[model samples]
Target: MPQVGSAHGGEPGLLTRVVEKVFRFVRLAEFEILFVLFFLIAFILFKDLMSRPQYNSIFVKKPDLDDRWP
Candidate 1:
């Protein structure tokens, strides 16, 4: 078996290298590209969160209508 931590082994495959290159290119792009990506994602998540109604306890029974003192 090849020795651990050797250059002959543990190298990323071609597809991985290509993906890394793509990520690097995007990372190196102008600030506008990153800003647009961030804003789009943030806007989508914020909209989704806002659209959901708050949860209510269905199992718990409401206090009796009578207003007797505790």
Candidate 2:
């Protein structure tokens, strides 16, 4: 059987290397990453709010019954 810490025979596996690189990148670009995430979340929320009729009642005029029929 292989040793617990020697699963890859003392070499880092592909997944281990990828995870380490991701962590290192995140640590280096923490502020930029947070800003992007914040912007994306805010944009999604704004879009969702605008899509709801109740939220945009003041901005949009209600169609009359005659307009719908014609």
Candidate 3:
């Protein structure tokens, strides 16, 4: 994807400013921060998925479906 503001020699976009500030906080270089952000978002998504309830149903009492029909 093209840089928000840096596209076609234009000024940087809002996205660029936000990303630049994030990288500054993390003490990472501009280029490196993009990679880090990608991994961080992926990790957060994975962690969130793993934290959800694993069971679907609480309990279900159903009659046997065997061939015991009369």
Candidate 4:
């Protein structure tokens, strides 16, 4: 079978290979930075909502005390 990749036999040199690897790494790092920022914003919003008294009241369960607790 004819070698497909060898047709262009001009394989990238070391510098090209290194630069491609660096760019790939930087692309992944960019996603990681965005991921961190997204979660950071979400956490801040959650914290702010929880800090408000109204938000806390929404989750509070009122206890039945007619004759259930005494």
**In TM-score terms, which candidate is top?**
2
The models' CA-based lDDT, in order, is 0.77, 0.91, 0.72, 0.84
lDDT of 2 by residue, 1-70 (tens): 6778776688999998999999999999999999999999999999998999888997988788777574
| TM-scores, all models, native as reference | 0.37, 0.64, 0.35, 0.50
- Per-residue lDDT value at 63 in model 1: 79
**Which pairs clash inside model 4?**
none
Model 1 C-alpha lDDT per residue in residues 1-70, reported as the tens digit of each score = 8877556488887888999999898788869797899999999988786666552234345677786955
TM-score of candidate 3 to 2 decimals: 0.35
Q: Is candidate 2 or candidate 3 better by lDDT?
A: 2
Candidate 4 stretches with Cα past 4 Å from truth are 1-28, 62-70
Q: What does candidate 4's lDDT look like per residue over 1-70, in tens digits?
A: 6656663466876788899999998897998988999999999999999999888878996676785664
Please identify model 2 stretches exceeding 4 Å from their true place: 1-9, 61-70
Tens digits of per-residue lDDT, candidate 3, 1-70, equal 5655455576677888899898687785756778989999999988787666562122444567885974
